[model samples]
Target: MKKMPVALMLAATVFAGVATYTVPAQAATNSVVKPELDEGMVKLEVYFSSYPPNNYSDENTGFNGWLVGVTPLPNGQYKGTYYGYMY
Candidate 1:
């Protein structure tokens, strides 16, 4: 009966270790807009929270969705994210 408890504890530890070591692969959230520039320029980046609209209406423009822009600081030291909408 005591052996059963020890086996359970060992199984739990193994399971926890496996869970900690495994990481699920996920798609990147943002992508660099300009990677060619190396110095003195705040790199621009853009990312979409959701897939842009595929269909367009007469009154509404297509590709209306959440758009995020990473703007470089004027000092060229840091970057900031600006959220905007389309349509």
Candidate 2:
């Protein structure tokens, strides 16, 4: 009985140690770019001169722009809009 408890505790300790082990995180070296527009996809370009209250503007251009892609649904019945911002 004593040996059985000792063996079970040892097995539990080993499992706990393995569960706590983790790989170190790494920093990305390459930048991620958006995918190219496919056929039948619609693109919308938006430019902003000034917002409001604070009147925020892009530091480099004094304005900002966004590119939105609208893709057709898989069912071919509707379209879905996707937007992403990268700074």
Candidate 3:
């Protein structure tokens, strides 16, 4: 009976060690690239608690915008970008 407890404790310690060793490697693999804008263009970034909304009304305001990308952040928010060219 005592052997069973000792074996379980050993297994947990080994698992914890493996988890700590691999976390940094996993984080390094996921890197975000910076967005680039070209001449005669503009970039706008916004954050949302959920998915971004459609920009159909932007045309009426003369922006003619569209979603460039949407990245989900670690803090339960979304980071989105809009790229548009003005008239």
Candidate 4:
């Protein structure tokens, strides 16, 4: 009989997750989307910036890459496979 309660709880959790997950898909797709930066390098997206930023300002050029996947190697230098615009 105790198993019945545990089973119901598990079932409820699964249903809750599915219901919450599927509901978001119905929202209207907007313009924000991550392009194919590289082969599995999409995880390197740092930030979102506007084009023609300040007419020609180098500071606000655009969303430069991020240090997302960068890692510290044994050489004490951080390195990672990055794919994006950088100056």
Candidate 5:
């Protein structure tokens, strides 16, 4: 009877080991997106930056400015927040 318990425990251990090895670990990947605007659309040509922004000023002689970051979602849509102000 004791042998039966030992065998069961050994089987359980082996099963657990197999499960751990066979199941692959999954990781999520996130990518950042940058937005572009027509140069003539808005006068804020300078602020149309990429993922890591560098400039936050309008090329034209204007006070309007914008700072934004965009990320693509799994639903095939973009998700992000924006902050616009006049400088």
Candidate 6:
């Protein structure tokens, strides 16, 4: 599997600015139950705790899915994530 780019990870995780991420007062929480990987692919596991419990799976199932893809830049100085562009 390809390793994640340091810069891209930094930009996304480190220097990334934050905005209010609103969630419904209900719904089931997420535990990243499973991931189906393709050949040469990998994943970064993340955890979520819902305020109302089981939010993602229960009520927010549609708008609340998961991030899946990451690709390193040509020069290897940066990386991009499919999740970054997605909600």
Model 4 residue 26 lDDT? 18
RMSD of each: 12.2, 15.9, 11.8, 12.7, 14.2, 18.7
* Regions of model 1 farther than 4 Å from truth: 1-4, 24-87
Clashing pairs in 5: none
User: Which candidate gets the maximum TM-score versus the true structure?
Assistant: 3
lDDT by residue (1-87, candidate 1, tens digit) is: 345688899999999999976862222233343234334323222333443222222234222222233333445432323222333
What TM-score does prediction 4 earn?
0.28
Per TM-score, what order, best first?
Answer: 3, 4, 5, 1, 2, 6
Q: Report lDDT per candidate.
A: 0.38, 0.38, 0.64, 0.41, 0.44, 0.35
**lDDT by residue for model 6 over 1-87, one digit each (tens)?**
999899888777644444223443232232333456545443332333312222122233223333442233355332212121112
Clashes of each: 0, 0, 0, 0, 0, 7
Error of 2 at 2 (Å): 9.0
TM-score per model over all chains: 0.25, 0.23, 0.42, 0.28, 0.26, 0.19
Please report, as a residue range, the 10-residue window in candidate 4 with the lowest summed lDDT.
48-57
Q: Candidate 3, which segments miss by more than 4 Å at Cα?
A: 1-38, 56-64
The list of candidate 4 runs beyond 4 A from truth reads 1-4, 25-60, 64-87
Which tens-of-lDDT digit does each residue in 1-87 have in candidate 3? 445688899999999999888754213322244346678877766688976653412555566555656778999997767776666
User: Candidate 3 — which pairs collide?
Assistant: none
Task: Give lDDT for model 4.
Answer: 0.41
